[model samples]
Target: MLEKVIRSPLILIVSLFLMTIMLWSVYYGAFSNVFESVLLFVLIIALSTFLFLILFHNKRNPERKISWKSWTPYELKEEDEGQQWVTYRATRKVYIFFYFAIPAGLMVVAVFRHIEFMPLVVLFVLGTTQYGIYWHESRKYLNDREEV
Candidate 1:
């Protein structure tokens, strides 16, 4: 179970976010001035990410094996390997969090923490780039090619 979650890209990304939050908390001292609502929101994001992966993990990515070497987005291209429809759907669902949900959460944190909004703006841009990259790669997965 642990290994599978660790292996999934979605899980890893969310984990990175959670780690960033933890580091911030540690640096700023335990949500000392931040509202509980903000903390609750962060927890919800983490839990939802984990649950989403748990539900979809086994269902997507079938016999087609994309080598571990190409798992990193920067190293990958628009080669269709895994199940098309399923992978596309999963990619969209996950990006909703990356492109919208996480930034909203960050904005909420910024509001409560009295931090500058620029960082969340930067996060939004990063999320947009991630979505663009994902969309480019996943488009190939959206169609089925008749074997020649």
Candidate 2:
């Protein structure tokens, strides 16, 4: 279970979000005070360790080759044509979502221009919505296959 969670795209998404938050805090001088500085140091160490573990695990996996020179996003293995089709469909749906979502998001940001974190809010919403669309489309395909 732990390994599955660690290998999932969910982990990558979450780690990226956390890193963004950390950077935002740093940029805003949220850790300017001594105690907060120490806390920030600890968080940096922890996140570094977590990322190291992920790298180590990826290194040990023979099937998933990762290198600094050629980085690839970790995705579910598409061993057959059917799996590839599912991925293609999911990607298409995500593209379609962005086609509509971008304009809507811009309008939302314009309306909420006074909110300090409105950009981040819109980013979070867009990210989650994209993932939701991909997951739902892929799951629907898998379910149809299973039902047959």
Candidate 3:
């Protein structure tokens, strides 16, 4: 999981760097603008395709190699119930922490760099939405548990 997180951000960083270069090249008219735009678009698409293939190929396997043994429905239901509440609570906490931390970090960086407010507002909204979704889901899970 740590490797997965690190790897994805590295890809994003590299992509951003490439995009910056492409933009600078276009601004300087070092290359034909049309050709540069097409090349950048193709690069982005190819990178996304490659990443998706690497990430999801395992889950997209056609072979059903693993078989499940029979179990009582009630037993399986109870097993799922045992972990649901704790899992939801943990997930909620994680989302809440990230929702605050990411924007706060971004704001600090933006202040240091004298960046504009529009990007910070966008980040704030995105983080708030994430927090809201996690909170709502966590509450629903808790309510469901109570009803049981």
Candidate 4:
């Protein structure tokens, strides 16, 4: 169970969401002083650094670093070249929404709610990084497919 969770990037996703919400709360006088904000910031940085090291660390064999079991939303089973190409294309399009639209929507909601800006900025970074990861994975998958 622990290994499965580690293999999934969902931890990173949840971590970002929680950290942002906490930041929003702390920054807007939810904690009564700057100490609380500083504490939250330290914790967020620590967690993010740990997760990033686990997610993107490269040892001797870089290809062995990432686990495919929980990285993608797709099934990614055996398929013909055409089918695989279609899957890759679909993944690309989906990430386009994830990259820009999601962050923009979040910011719009935040603005309406009068939330702090730092959280939204982190969210935008998360969105952009998620897209970059998805793009790199798609490219690698497509290239591996062609080689096969």
Looking at model 1, residue 5 earns an lDDT score of 49
Q: Candidate 1: give the clashing pairs.
A: none
Tens digits of per-residue lDDT, candidate 2, 1-43, equal 4345555556556755665565556655545567556666776
Cα displacement (angstroms), candidate 3, residue 98, comes to: 3.7
**Comparison by lDDT, 1 against 4, better one:** 4
Model 1: lDDT of residue 19: 56
Q: What is the TM-score of each candidate against the true structure?
A: 0.33, 0.71, 0.30, 0.41
lDDT of each: 0.54, 0.71, 0.53, 0.60
What is the per-residue lDDT of model 1 for residues 1-148, given as tens digits with 9 covering 90 to 100?
A: 6434434445545655665555566555656646445765777887776556644643465443333433454223334555545456656666675767666766667676756444544554465556555644554444444332
> What TM-score number comes out for model 2?
0.71
Candidate 3's residue-wise lDDT over 1-148, tens digit each?
A: 4234323434444555565556556665657878798879877796776556544543554351111234221111223654565455646676676768777766776776654333444444454545455545655665787799
**Collision pairs in model 2:** none
- Candidate 4 per-residue lDDT, tens place, 48-105, comes to 7756655555443476454543555432532587657756665676667576867677
Top TM-score: which candidate number?
A: 2
Ranking by TM-score: 2, 4, 1, 3
